[model samples]
Target: MEKTWNNKAWFMVLPVLLLVAFSAVIPLMTVVNYSVQDTFGNNQFFWAGTEWFTEMLTSERFHSALGRNLFFSFIILLIEIPLGIVIALNMPRKGWGVPVCLVLMALPLLIPWNVVGTIWQVFGRVDIGLLGHTLERLGINYNYVQNPMHAWFTVIIMDVWHWTSLVVLLCYAGLVSIPDAFYQAAKIDGASRWAVFRYIQLPKMNRVLLIAVLLRFMDSFMIYTEPFVVTGGGPGNSTTFLSIDLVKMAVGQFDLGPAAAMSLIYFLIILLMSWVFYTVMTNYDAER
Candidate 1:
């Protein structure tokens, strides 16, 4: 007997498709329209045909912002991934301490991004803020508002504080999902802690690690709110990543055409890099 499929399920999906079209697709099409055209006001638009794209591609400002974005993402991954794994590894597998640790780990993640930035922004000030006051008393010249390096440091630290919790949670979930039998067997084999981590835990957590890496990388690359709130892309544009730069162009400078083109390029770069990350990690997982 042949089975008949119900076509009604697509009707259920139609609302979602409509929502996506209204929210994402329409705005994207508008950006595309603006990207290839020039406007001098009064709704008058003329065909420019890739002029904005070419200008953005060859612009030094674009290169600098892209470099900062890449470097920031790299630093975030380097610090967060290993730090999260180590924290997860040390967390209690069972006990009253488990919930406490988990809640504490989650607290930072629960804070809104902009609030986190604001908190750090004030906290890093050299006058009334506890951290800044303490540093000043300790004879350290720390001021995020004035020094470029300090601004970068503050941004990096704020990001790590806010987002590392996410990585920790992901790693913790992966750790908790492993069967006790694996640990028991490793123990019976007299495996050292490093051996257990290397031969068992790391392999078990591969998928989650991949997830953590990708999420952290993308978030760091596209970081805007926190850094913007904290530094306002100041200290000589030292912390101006791509997202911040795009916003400066679109909103601050009102260069809509260039901004639209840059945004498309930004989207493609993220898509391509994410694909590369997924492919490489999945292939490695397969090989192992």
Candidate 2:
């Protein structure tokens, strides 16, 4: 007997589709309209073809912001992935310690993005902040407002603190899902601790690791709130990544045409990079 296909499920999903179109699709179309056209006061718009796109692509500001975004994202992935894996591996697999470890790992991820930025902003002030005051006492010239390198360092560290927990949680979930039978077999075979982790835990965690890496990369690339609050893209734009620069162009300078074009380009870049990451990792999973 042939099975009948289900058509009713799509009706269940129709509301969600309409919601997405309303929320995402409509706004995106508005941005596209702005991107290809020029606007003046009084709601007047004129066709500018690709002028804004061309100008954005050729601008030195765009290049600098893009480079900063790439660099910050790369560094975040590098530090967070390994650090998370190590923390996950060390976490207790059972007993009372498990809940404690899990809660600790989750605390950073629970904070709102803007609140995290606010907390850090206050926490890093030279006179009032614990971290900055301690550094000052140690005779370290650690001023995020005055020094570009210090500003970058503080922002990177803040991000690592806030988001590394996500990677840890993902990896921990992957680790915990491994059956006890596998560990029993490894034990029976007299596998070393290193060998067990290398062959068993690492392989099991690969899928989650890929997910963690991609999430961190995308979030870090588009980071705005925390960095904005902490550094305000200060010290001559040293820590101003693409998101910050885009906001400055759009809101601060009121250059809607260029800003819209830049935003679309930024969105495309993120989409393309994420697709590449997903494809490569998925292919690797398939191969293995």
Candidate 3:
């Protein structure tokens, strides 16, 4: 006997599709429309084709911002991935310590992004802020508002403080999911701690590590709020990543055409890079 399929399930999905169209698709189409046109006010728009895209591609400002984004993401991945793994490895696998450690790890992640930015912004101030005041008393010339290097340091540190917990949590979940049988087998084989980690634990955590890397990479690359609140893209545009630059163009300068084009390029770059990361990591997993 042949079975009949119910078509009503698609009806249940229709509302979600409509919501996505209204929220994401329509705005994207508007950006596309703005990207290929020029306006001189009074709703007058002229066809400019790829003029904005070409200009953005050739701009030194764009290159600088892109470089900053790449460098920041690289630093975040380098620091957070290994740091998170180490923390996860050392965390208690059982007992009362587990909940305490988990809760502490989750506290930072619970803070709102804007609030985190605000907290760091004040925390790095030279006069009243504890960190800045202590550094000053210690005769370390630290001021995020004036020194580009200090601003970069503050942003990087703030980001690590705020987001590293996510990596820790992911790694911990991966670690906890590993069966005790694997540990037992490793122990029977007289595996050292390093050997167990290298041969057993690391392999098991491969998928979560990939997730952590991709999430951290994308977040760091598109970072805006925390750094913006902390540095305002200055002490000399030193911390001006792509998202900040795009906002400066769109909202600060009101160059809608160029902003729209840059945004599209920004979107594509992120999409391509994420795809590359996923492909590389998945292939490695498959090989292993």
Candidate 4:
């Protein structure tokens, strides 16, 4: 028997496809155009080939920013993944406590990005802020404004406070989705808590864990507003990441050509890394 496939469903999705092309594709093409060209004024552009790209590739400033971005992402993943898992495991899995815990976890995620930055910016001030004042009273020499290490610490803690909730929620959802029968079987086998988590929970959470990792990695890599508000990439470029550097080039210095080129490179790096992450995780899941 010959089976006829219904192709009409594509028509329903055509509107969404057009919306994406308009919002995403057109802007990307514009960036690609600027990346290869130079313009001074009067809506004029001159082709400079790949000169901007080559310059960015050779620039030490770009290298430093890229290094900062990679390091921050690595630190975030290291801190968040296991911490999220632990918090999720400890959270109440049943009764009214479940909803209360979930709401609290979600509160941080509800705040706007800029708002989070602003909150941390003032909160870390030494004189008037509770955290800074408490630290000072405790004889701690903490000053994010002048000290690079303190700046890094403040930014990291702020991010953890804001985004760890997301990871916790993801892991918690994964944990709760497992059937009670799994726990019953583990109990029948007289499995220890560690063994149950190591085998049943971890394997069950693998798919959501992959999603959480990818999401966190990409967001951390492209982080901008919060750090910008808090540090302004200050204290001598100590905390400047790729997104901040790109903004400095494009808007701060008006170096649109190099900025556009850098933006394209940044986009490619993210695309490539995300593909690599997806491929590796899916392969590992398949093997397991």
Instruction: For each candidate, give its TM-score against the true structure.
Output: 0.93, 0.91, 0.93, 0.91
List the global CA lDDT of all models: 0.92, 0.94, 0.92, 0.94
Each prediction's RMSD to truth: 2.4, 3.1, 2.4, 3.0
Residue 235's lDDT in candidate 3? 88
Residues 4-85 of candidate 2 have per-residue lDDT tens digits of 8978878998999999999999999999999999999999999999999999999999999999999999998899999999
Q: What does the lDDT come to for candidate 1?
A: 0.92
Clashing pairs for predicted structure model 2, backbone only: none
Candidate 4: C-alpha lDDT: 0.94
Off by over 4 Å in 3: 1-14, 281-288
- Candidate 4 at 121: error in angstroms? 0.9
Candidate 1: count the clashes.
Answer: 0
Residue 215 accuracy (lDDT) in model 1: 88
lDDT (Cα) of model 3: 0.92
240 Cα displacement, candidate 4 (Å): 1.2
